[model samples]
Target: MKKLRKMFVLMGTVTLMVNFCSFNILAEDGIKQVSEVQTINPRSGNVYYKYKIINGKKYKRLWSADKNAWVDPYWTLA
Candidate 1:
């Protein structure tokens, strides 16, 4: 009985570690997208835009070289 209980505990620990690692991997993808969006910059006379979706809504913002910031207050709906 003691051996059986130890086996179950080991299995549970392995399952939890696998789940935690997968969640971290998924979160890293989101962080990568945000970092990519932040790197966009307007060139010459053209305006550069980036979009992100959140909560089933699409939002967009443009880089402004004149003001050195994003044009929208909190990302307007695209």
Candidate 2:
């Protein structure tokens, strides 16, 4: 009986650790998406744009313009 209890406790600890690690990974990806969205700017109409300075060349990427707000589609996945 004592050995069974110890085994149960060990299994519980391992399960908790696995859950925590998965949560951390998901949260990290969310943070990265938030940071990327901050650099975008939407213009008039339903069109949005974001310019990035890379190698001294400006690269523009399409974004979404909704009610004067620029939103990145990557972070909007449900």
Off by over 4 Å in 2: 32-78
Candidate 1, 43-67: lDDT as tens digits: 6554578789999999899977666
Candidates in order, TM-scores: namely 0.39, 0.40
lDDT tens digits by residue: candidate 2, 1-78: 999999999999999999999999998876643334366664555776677776666666556555555455432212
| lDDT score of residue 66 within candidate 1 | 65
Q: Which sections of candidate 1 miss by over 4 Å?
A: 32-78
Q: How far is candidate 2 from the true structure (C-alpha RMSD, Å)?
A: 20.1
Candidate 1: residue 24 Cα off by (Å): 0.3
